[model samples]
Target: MATESARSERAGGVSSLRGLAGGGVFLPGDEEYDRARTTWALAVDLRPAAVAFPTSAAEVAAVVRAAASAGLRVAPVGTGHNAHPLGDLTDSVLLRMSGMSRIDIDPDARRARVEAGALWLPVIEAAAAHGLSALHGSSPDTGVVGYSLGGGVGWYGRALGLAANSVTAVELVTADGSLTRVDAEHEPELFWAVRGGGGANFGVVTTIEFTLYPIETAYAGMLVWDLRDAHRVLSRWARWAADAPDAVTTSYRHLQYPPIPEIPEPFRGRQLVIVDGAVLADDAEAERILAPLRDLGPELDTFGRVPAATLARLHMDPEQPTPGGGQSALLDELPPAAVDRLVEVAGADSGSSLFLAAELRQLGGALGRSQPGAGAVARLDGQFQLITGGMMVGEFAKQTVADCERVVDAMAPYSRGRQYLNFQEEAVDPSTGYDASTWDALLRLRKNADPAGLFQANHEIPHR
Candidate 1:
């Protein structure tokens, strides 16, 4: 392996990286370097020593070997949605895998083989054509491999469980430049580690195979009410969520829309409380399940039988790149008192400075139960998930960091003292995302898989 001096010498140029087979190498001064290094989260500005786009798993291995020879680490990025947590990348090689986006759906087997670079949108569309659906997150644009490896929680999560749990196999390039396939029957430990321990920790994943559900349509949509009813809506949601069946997955958001043309006319420059979710049942069953909330008389109700492909847009997440700050936490429960506390801090009358969207996602059902021989993060022990974020624009950008912390601080009492790895915006202890046993097992497995410490990027598991 190359030494520190060798790495420093190679940092000035990308000639060695360019010599690699089956990939594109980009240096700081390269024409595409800036665009290649840009991420979905506009807040992240990365300046890596080099950026490489590998077309195949063999090419990925070649890049890994090259980086090892240059005494540099590799940070594999897909769609770059979680780039903010990666911190500095000066000494690393950013591996851009968006070029290998290929999805093969096996409707007979009820599974989809997704390449690392594939996004959820294409996969969802492909599955929908076969009247099937994968456990995909809210945003269709999010990368599949990254989201699945980090324990994806989607609109159908309550019914089908996490996306990570659905993964049946993974193909990756190990630290020694060897391409390996892992699954329950092969490399079982590594399979467990990658499922929810966070990808890019033990190796660079090239593709993943996950199971899909047989469903063409379901009852899904959003219900909106003026901010005046924030407390009442939230309280009802909390109570409903507690006893909600496995068929329903829901969340409530307190939104403060900016006075911008991008926002809808009625919602722009206003504070609104919205309840959004999906029920994996027919219209009649869904209506029965959602009858209580419907009886509350929302100002706007859009619930109806919708195609599974359309579920991704229910949250109304920005389809284009966005600049924002985000923070999240897993909560033990959202009791009445906790609901009051949240409304007091993030409600319309709260005069809050940083939060543009504050939400509490219902957690339970399949998410609360661990499957036999599950992955690293077997189950989420919490009852609800709290997420708060703000658009980072102009003055708000500077205050976002502090404001995020302030919200987290205020909600500390109800926190489970844990966080979801995918939603974390900063580097946090891996222990926070797992139990003691799982954390320890992950550390041991990471060390064994990447003994040279070649792959250490965002939310990395320390070798020691």
Candidate 2:
């Protein structure tokens, strides 16, 4: 993809895209260029030919129309959370919906109508006001539409279906530059495809309406352990997670916290074991169920009643920007043997600072329950998803892909031959991400919806 400056040069040396509605178009030299193009990953750098910050769906439609008429491409972005810096769009028109932030909660119907730019925090806060909750991302800072497009899996995924499953309707700008509303009752096929097809394949999503659940506060937090016991902690978590009840969801992560004053003293500058536990129910029930795991010798136990507003901080994920790499796979089962094998590869003994964090999130339960028109969701029936990610550096920097594969091979005995789209690192063969049946269906849908292959730059899917 060409940069905005390069694209504009080709377009008669014009800086702003003409005929765009409402707001002024941002060109190459604009002061907002840098801030507008940055994403959460710090890896993705997008220099669009122009950025149209549409305040209304009509303005968005205008930008799409102009781009289509000028033979330019449009890639929608939401706070750039899912973006990878290397995924450049030099000649494209980046349609940023960040200015379109709006949240409308219909408590009576237990639903929320969200604009494409609304982050999970707003939705959670809005729903909390009505004693309702949505299947939002573990990190509330993540974009709602982007997460859903990648098949939203959250802390409560075991009890409720994916965030994608909660979608009731969407307003999209299709390939031909038409703004259309899609639902189970309207344009059902497209609706099915967009449920989890990944974004920008079919069109630009402007607004989305999704179902909400009644959950104000629950028992959720992490139990941290010293790196010395990483092996024991990892092994124990594996078995305990396998038999965990539906209401109890947890993920095991081995992380190296930077030596920063903001970081707690116990966790700062050390390889620590953290078990993220969430119970979307009353405190007593959660405490009883989590007691066994809690007794497993944690250095610091932060598990207790906490406000939902502070949920994002519990994970303590990196807030700073840096280039990184990651990979993930679904497991059919994690028996005692499988747990032992995983401990060998990713445990404390696994001599790889390259492995910043490896997480094992328990899957299945409500996630396995099929919903109408679900498309390309990752590991619905799997028992767990094994994921690893870290900053790309030194020899390890160039070997992210190989390391990811190495992790996968080490755990192959328990893997179910399924992959999670979000956790996929660059250089991963696309066909491996989806099962054969899913790959075939995705190809057929791609041929039907985007025969021109305009969105191929963002992802790889064989289109005849």
Candidate 3:
């Protein structure tokens, strides 16, 4: 089915796309083009010259070769959660990888092999079936590959560290259009780069293999308080998290539920404060650890033992795709002044219209320490990852962006001036996501592997 790009001598450099055998291609004028280019972030409008869905490795290779041959860059995406930064895809072939969703669990070895498009939900469930679990983030639908590439911080992050470091091997289609397998032994440097340095700078990853843990369950749930109690709750949580034991990981959030029919009546249009996470300890020990927060008397406390798979949906992130934008910053320990600034910006009386005003995920434990043979992101350099954002589809889009920025900027006094790439939506200096030496190594490797600049990543590591 030749469309505008192919018919017009492959304008935008998407020539010879007919070679994609396993999946289909949608050009600029095709009816499916809009739908194909749509990412999980509906707010991000991506009108690339072409969008290709490749089901197998061979097809990915074909698309890569075709785009490179025609002087087009290939931008591979799964759910497109972080697609906002890949602006102006006029000469880019958007290789949508969702068609290649596949998962294979090796219970004996406690490992799983998943395709680029696989979401964290199925992988979480699969691992749980064998009395194991993967370090998946709050949202189940997040693409595993993209999350890991950007340094994944999940409910288990404090204890287990970032998900990228758990990767064992990666199979990708490189610039030369060759299907290459990289691991600690084979293409070690490339393997290191892909795990945390961002794969888009080198190739379109087809599959990823990662190690799983023997976690069948943990003491996990949420503690909720009325919006009026946000200042107290946040202050208490900030102190508790600073020296919180490594056996637990938690996040504090100020959530404003919308008064929409889709939402349940209990929380509809209600503003509240929430602190939730998992505790990797026995019942008595967990109880002892949570005593300080419990003393504050939350309106709701459901922290108890549950099956590991349940942790995937514990955070209650919107299951479906929604139009939203957010801002995040890595922060040092927050003093009383920082807490005051946060309350001033996003609290109940702050005129903030965001659904999720502010979230501070406790970081330390394994996350603060670099392990042997770690990837590009050796360790998260801050004690807490602060994020604030809201839905942006309606007339409040401008307000939402401004409100989010206000919260982040107000807390700048405590910021580490670093980037947690997974939570960063806007264009930031990529080097902020890494240190000095790691950035230079990744750049040199990218130039050698992709001299012609064949691939485009959301947070691109520029070769030139």
Candidate 4:
């Protein structure tokens, strides 16, 4: 079905990529091309002309050079966990980093250096092996570089700050196919842009070096309640978390689990309210600190001590692809009145989606402190990030997004006028997601570093 001219153009692009290191390119007609281009977000259907699995940073540079010469857009792909709201690549040269998977933990330095292609699972497992833990996102399946680059916020964010703040160094391949190392001491401008600025705005990160902490165990998990108690639970949770220590982070969701055999009978196909949370720094103090929450009436309680590797199960975010839409806002505060209003909009009584998950992460503590000389990672200081997401398909996608915005707009009173980069579902103007000053600062850095606009992927910060 290809036009002769278009076919010729693609052939030319394919030919130019053939000699680039690690392996040959995956062209459109190739049998494995479709499988290789699939992203974790089921809704994203990528149609890249080619996918290049670079074995090294030099090879990544080579791919960028070839794309530049062929006038093709370049994108970086890691664990493909671009989550809903973040657009995926189309008709671009996907510089898939899967081949670059590598992780090294320096016990003495209490730091870990990982390739851009690696997922957080390996990092958590590796860190746990040494009785240490890295500041990673909720899902262990998320790519470290991809998440950290977007200022990853996890259960420990309040205690440790966004994951990007823990990064010490980055090795990136820029627009001109040149390699550059960024950190507080080197390429300070690019360093600022890469931290929490989102991906594709700067360059393709090859590897990242970040600090890790020593944490052996914590009290974590969730409690499930019937939909009838959703309003009451929401109000109680709002008040309890307001005074919660930085060590604790929690989120509540109004969900209707499908009646599948995989789902427990008690929760199957039933509307329910569940609280998922974690206590990061202390095990003994967790019980006393979280007692107020635990005392709230709930049908089921599953909290207990757990290792970091199994933390992803706490939220139990589906691993497989599902059609969904999501939107997010950074919250300045969450009071009981605000929670009551939120319940009015998306609670069990609302005949919207069968599932609606609203997360509230406690902020302050280390999250409010700036990492000295952290360049870009130091820009984030949001008090709390609120996200409302749902799984919907086909014609309902638009309705879902609209429904989400209603909740977002209704909660504007408590918002910080910022959005979480990861939860964004649409192609948003880069300026709207960050604080005005933060956006301006990122723009200044992008202008100086990735002035050519080469790397563009999830939640992209375009070259100005």
User: Candidate 4: deviation at residue 138, Å?
Assistant: 1.1
Candidate 4 or 1, higher lDDT:
1
RMSD, each candidate, Å?
A: 1.9, 3.3, 2.8, 3.0
Q: Rank the candidates by lDDT, best first.
A: 3, 1, 4, 2
* Best by the lDDT measure: 3
TM-score of every candidate relative to the true structure: 0.96, 0.89, 0.97, 0.91
Give the runs in model 3 whose Cα sits over 4 Å from its true position: 1-15, 19-23, 354-356
Model 4: runs farther than 4 Å from truth?
1-11, 19-21, 83-91, 281-284, 377-382, 395-399
Candidates' lDDT values, in order?
0.87, 0.73, 0.88, 0.76
Runs of candidate 1 exceeding 4 Å displacement = 1-7, 10-14, 21-23
Q: Residue by residue across 77-100, what tens digits does model 3's lDDT show? A: 989988888988877899988888
Q: For residue 145, what is the lDDT in candidate 2? A: 88
Say what the RMSD of model 2 is. 3.3
For candidate 4, what is the TM-score? 0.91
Per-residue lDDT of model 2, residues 1-464, tens digit only? 55776555556533436546565577678887777666666755567777778888888777776776665667787766556522556657777788888999999999999999998888888888888888876776777888887678887788887878788898987766678898989987777777777656777889999998877776998898876687777677777777778997788887767788987788778887788867987888898888888888777777788766666556665555557767778888877777676666666677655546778887877777776567566346578888877766566665555655667788888876766666565545656666678777777886776675544224456446
